[model samples]
Target: MDAPFSMYGPDFPFAYDHWLKHPEGLGRIPVNRHGAKVAIIGAGIAGLVCGYELMRMGLRPVFYESGQLGGRLRSASFEGAEHMIAELGGMRFPTSSRSFYHYLDLMNLKTAPFPNPLTPAAGSTVIELEGERFYAKTLSDLPPIFQEVAQAYDSALEEGAHFSSLQAAIQRRDPNAIKAIWNPLVKAWDERTFYDFITTSKAFRHLSFRHREIFGQVGFGTGGWDSDFSNTMLEILRVNVTACDTDQHLVIGGVEQLPKRLWSHEPEDLSYWPNGTSLQKLNQGAPRPGAAKLFRDPEGLYVTDRRGHTDRFDAIVCTCQSWLLTTAIDTQESLFSQPLWMALDRTRYMQSAKTFVMVDRPFWKDRHPETGEDLMSMTLTDRLTRGTYLFDHGPDQPGVMCLSYSWMSDALKVLPLDAEKRTELALSALSKIYPDVDIKSHIRSNPITVSWENDPNFLGAFKGALPGHYRYNHRMYGHFMQQTLSPDHKGVFLAGDDISWTPAWAEGAVQTALNAVWGVMNHFGGQSSLANPGPGDVYPVWGPIDLDELS
Candidate 1:
């Protein structure tokens, strides 16, 4: 499924390109809208995708970028070695993100299976905790205690949340069954946190504290759940039911390529601009400076850039991180209503950090002379360094290693250190796992590190909704259905992953951008045909459960 609780038939969930190609979707925009200008703030994927589709609908999109072109999908390369890149943001994407794959397929970007735990790509896994090391080539190779913990997790997913029933219902696209199973979940779990679900569930309650601690430190699919323990149960459920945590793949080179391609690619046939028109060309080969302030005028919405240059457009799509509206940009109070402003302001973002180093070779592949085990395939530990990943380019070519990947408290730990210091700290921690391997000797270049929480362009990595935040999420996610919104919110639309049902994923960003596109088209007197209605036309019937009534 594209999203856990989408209004669309579960089978048809997140078929974004299908909706765009449908006669009703394509025909919704009025011909008169041709040549009309729309301002898109932030050159991220959401903004770029929205602009790309809007241009196809015969509207001109002028863009504003405050920082680099590819917002959170950042990929940094070493000074001399450009081929070996370190992904600082959005490293892996699951297969369930079908809507996002549309762009990847369109771009013909290469991909390889990500080395998630127990996956084939992760040749082996080493779990280290409390001065003990356990190496496993597969899940079965682990000790019985670990196996029991994994089983308990699976059972909890089914018994506590009706995981199996819901999965079957979604597979069959049974709307009635979906509502029956999912609606109650929203009401019950919305007020609870992930930790609450784990501890309160009978399956986990029976286990010892050590078992629970191990489960928290080395989670099944990705790594750990401790970072997200305080987030709402609904958020974790969404990740599980939709399978966003498994069967993931990494974009070759970098995830940033998707948006960069959309920025320059010109669709076939004619719109108002011309056959060869693209967002890059429309903006005169570069985006206007970052939007510094926004205010409404008699003619339309006005945006003033950091350089004091101002531009006016009929409508504005604010795709920047929500926090920027309140902190970075000076937005007029009247632009959005108070409750909407509250929702935006309350959007909580999670902190994340990553440190990467290029090594002379894939020395990690060497078997430990004494243990007969591979030094480390993918390492997960409870040390200062949470997770470490190794990327083997080739046997001879230099390898890239993500020395340390952490979140929340762990992320904050290295915020004060520079790249060299961060590398030293990571190496010190990793030495405990592989004392025989001289990791420092294999290092070829200076390490690259990032603390997303400290980056000025993004206050934090992505939104992590807390318990009791459903009402706020409801307002933000449903803002595109114009009839339900106030007049003040009509001219300005929000489009970003943070506003979506599944935050921090590119699919959510794409889905919300499409919602904003439909809203903008409707604002200019567009309508979807009855037979092949756009997402907006069918959203009321198939959309998210109304938490307001439950409240």
Candidate 2:
């Protein structure tokens, strides 16, 4: 009935996928403006992508990085092992992320279904919460309460958000229909929390509090929703409508490869740059040192690196976490309006910690003699180690295990611990759930761990918007339409998953980067091809709704 699932926006309902797939190409700048330099801060997916697309348009994008090239798409390899890596961030990417997939396929990388809980790829899942454990091959295999929880969430979506109709409109790419249903929701739910939605809904209220608790531990498409309970209901609804939690997959080599390849890979088609030209060659093999200060002067916008080397550009794209503007960098207050600055300062990010280890082999697949159950399974629990995922490389080679993956308060518990200590704490918790299995006996390498909040470059893993913060998100997201802004705030742009409706998801990063590309092109006095309209072309008619004081 509906087309293949896509995140076409219940907010800004534009077809970015079609725009990317079109034959006419994104657009072209005036011949005189072809070599204009745009400074891109941070080398994350957003920064790298902004660089890549601008490179294709023949504009020079100078990158400034304070840390690793791949920001949140971090993958750490074992000491000696080449490909045995632990994904530190952005593991499960949903199929609905067509914009991201466009680049993924262009790079010619491979993907396999992610091992999400209760999915076929996982083979089996074990959910342990409140001291009770259950093994299930699918949702039906779980006890009645699990099924009740699942059904109740579906019913609540229909009751509170008109999810079916809204999703159908998105699937159809029907802007008018989507806006009709979604705009009202923004008004009604902008001030409500995700926990409030669950408690107030008849679907969830009909069941006991245990139903809500169990559902939080094992939510659809991913590990847990408990970490997101305090977030705004509008944020949660966007994830659901976009299918951000379903049909997910992972890059086999590692997600970091996405940025790595894009940096070095040269596109066959080019407007002004030569075919062999790449972002890497342009930057002379590495990015400039980390940025320490940014200010606007009479000449243009000036970006100062950590080494005090300063460079000026006509435009700039800031792809780092917004907080960096205040905490890490000496950004001039005049660079943005007070309202826009408020949105950036007010943006919230959630903490995340992951501890991973390389094992001898896929030993977890080994079955018990007493019963045919797996020795261990992809786990979801209420303990300190909230979610543990198993990765099987092959029967012959070694395997990878995410000993513990947690967020919010759970992440803070291990924020102060070292890698070894975190691993020990995780193994201790797993032993409680799988008492018979000596998980330590199978270990083959030292543990690798990350607490993003501990890293000054990245204050937190990603954003989690709270109630009444929708306006902040709106202000940051739509600021790219800088035509109406004063001269000072027009050139610098913000682009990241944090600025997107679906925070923490890679698609959000991809979509917003594309939006920044459009804004930059327009800033340079360029327009999209008439044959295939870009987001900017359709944005005026399909942009996100405006919620003002009068409303």
Candidate 3:
């Protein structure tokens, strides 16, 4: 599918080569050089990418992961059968991830084209309003209010080159126009709910019932909720990376391979810190003299597991949930007071859930006898329940059907239900969509659910901007390097998805890593090039720098 707008066009200009330069070149404070040892916290996509870039730049980056790698790109297995991968956190990727594609080429991975459900299983959508189910297809199909909003949206999109332009047109109050369009679109985008936009915005007041229909039609038109921009990046990575093998698609096996390949070192030269010993070394290297002095140290960083072990690092790049960092550091006066840290804590995230249900038969294949179409349907329903979506698993598994039930915020509140209870609630909910099926029996026999809340490392799925949060902040996370007082600080730096233009996706992680590498190279006075070089040319084959002398 073509991108909605060209992110690389002149209007949205980006500097690739300039970004490849060192962070110090941008007049940012530089890190102090202690030993060449770099410590990376969190083995998720961001951590892995940063480590890969650091290793390529001749710095030894030791990665510390409290849990398994691929923090959010996690998967689960069924009852002793073929291990079906379920994206407990992030589920899809987008096509605009150019850097991600480049990295994939470097890694050597392949892609399996996702089946388009546009034809065979093309399901209709239904909106539950005032206890009535309304079929929502064309603009005219929705309630009158929604129809007017839909028309306004179509007009806005047609008249203006971009949404922002359309908004400007609305602000101008063209006499020829029938009604305002900006309020609805902006509200929907901000609230993630058309209803909220309509009820709250004064501009929507003049919209006729028919104009309002446009809101529902456009909102649920083509791409449903599960479709993510990150999927394209994944495909690019699959096609490009030589080191990445597709056969091993499991997160533990395949995704984890990225860091292992980057950190591919001889056993003799590597010091494995499975526990928290490495963190201790980072604390010891703190520039300040006392415990309070620890916070004053420029390289002061900390990583903690709920299990009680807390480790510090010289330069820490955390790619975990924004809220986790906020809550964890709330009581610590030192960390929260920092300007960068304070901004990060204020960021809000959207909540979502994914449920995987294994059915006794591929019930979706059966056609509705009356309608003569596939009985299965996928809908973006009111924010009433968790499982708002429905889809089929495809031909690979003939008789098995997998249903994904997702709800944004409301669902997250009651998540992490014990397995048995979760299965019971899921089956109960599935019965609403597939009323005829024996959901209880099917669920009793086979059922599974992935609750992000239960995940200790990742408190939620992905980071989403809350209402009014985006306006206050432009950059999603901190972008530049800071000066460290210690001699070792020069080589130490931070890289994570939470620290780049694109956040909460694999692409962000890749970009963050690239930025970190460029920052390090710039600090060390290395030349930047875009040539495609082999692993040996890109990364130093020699082992890590000696750390014994520095200690």
Candidate 4:
């Protein structure tokens, strides 16, 4: 039988998990180059991962942050509450995300099953659409119409995308088998949108348009997918084939703790660094200020901070959002070729907004007096709130409530609202669905809200590749392979979820950061272990397929 599903490359099918777990460790830099400085722009998860691995390889990684240390992984605690927190960004992680788990396990963090739409973790689910409400303990509890909608999408995936066989290939870790199916699909679907695939598929075409609408509103694993209808079908396919939307778990306490712990974590085995040395020790107590400019001085690559403090490095890895390069930093144009610049400039980001309120307790689980059904459940709605999730912190302890978690248009709708107004808007929409439940009376703390797009440091939540934008993704994802690049562009690399095939997943950030680590090591004349070749060592052989430019 094939091995359990892993986030292996349907695109660049390298086993980053195996490479990281190898006994030989991730190659090495020259002894003379052990203390060479490398600038890591942005202290987000991606930046932290890159810095941690580079430090293990005996390189000193200097971090620069524009905002807080966690970046989008901000987990702000409620006033007066010590343990409860609002996870404002990337929360759900799949079991398939082995590379991310590699570090998460190393940090000794724990995770509980995320309360996705119909998972056991949720206990119960409430789907509200078109002002109608339906509660289900499982998918079988839903009406036949909902069942039909789900079946049609399943049939569509099998008929249109060869879903099962492709997934089996990924599970088996057969790069050749995956590419044979995926490369052809890339050519066939690169210019097609997700909506196009849904409308034109024989299975979906046979079903009513209402089925399609219901499918979008109550999407598989998560909530609504309607916001991503305009994205490339490849993006959606990648998420499905990788199980990125299935069997997800959330980091206990807060996801921020992973990056925070990694910042101070000292690897059991490392090169050159003294015992008990940590990333915290290398950079003194805190990171330098935000990088305001990226330009090359005659001597070396230079990073100028917002306060005009400057540092030179042998190489740099930028983990900030792509938009920041153009809007916030004065990066010399020559550092990137015209096509690459265009690719970065043209990359699209989907807006996402979230609102959270700490409640006195997990009141949502209380059953109605007359009915046996749950008083409230993990909610998915077409209303302004879009999706609502409840966090249970034992039976009596206070719980956190995510009032709204929305993306794209739904997110933009409340982009201008304050936390109080956003909370009011969410409660108003939810009232129509759960008029009997008084969510307002149970509130215990000030609401927390975030519109990532409104933050200059991150122009938007994450990337959303449009139809025909495959080339742009190709350019950005492959930028870390600097062997063929001009000397000017060789030293600088990009690593983030946005620079990955599967954006919005922490695994993407982890994998891309590994690629950047490989890039930095190779820049200093380092090499990978023969037994455990890095992504760069085998990238040329197993890299993503390239489509014709004319097409």
User: Which stretches of candidate 1 lie above 4 Å from their native place?
Assistant: 1-14, 21-27
For residues 224-288, write the lDDT of model 4, one tens digit per residue: 78999999999999999999989999999999999999899988677989979888889896889
Segments of candidate 3 deviating more than 4 angstroms: 1-35, 104-151, 154-161, 164-205, 208-218, 221-314, 323-337, 383-404, 439-446, 467-478, 481-495, 525-527, 530-551
Between candidates 2 and 3, the TM-score winner: 2
Query: Which clashing pairs does model 2 show?
Result: none
What digit string (tens of lDDT, one per residue) describes model 2 on residues 1-551?
66677899988988888888888888888889998999999999999888898899889999999999989999889988878989999888999998899889999988999999999999899998877889988999999888998899999999999999999888888889999999999999999999999999999987998889887888867978989999999999999999998889999989889999999999988788987999999899999999999999999999999999999999999999999999999999999999989999999999999999999999999997777899999999989899999999999999999999999999999999999999999999999999989889999999999999999999999999999998999999987788888997889998999998888998898889988999999999988999977787887888888889547
- Residues 119-200 of candidate 1 have per-residue lDDT tens digits of 7888888889998988887889999998888898888889888988887776555767877888788889898999889888
Alpha-carbon RMSD of each model: 2.3, 1.0, 11.8, 1.1
lDDT of each: 0.84, 0.91, 0.42, 0.91
The TM-score measured for candidate 1 stands at 0.96
List residue ranges in candidate 4 displaced over 4 A.
549-551
Better of 3 and 4 by TM-score: 4
lDDT of 1 at 418: 94
Q: Candidate 4 overall Cα lDDT vs. reference? A: 0.91
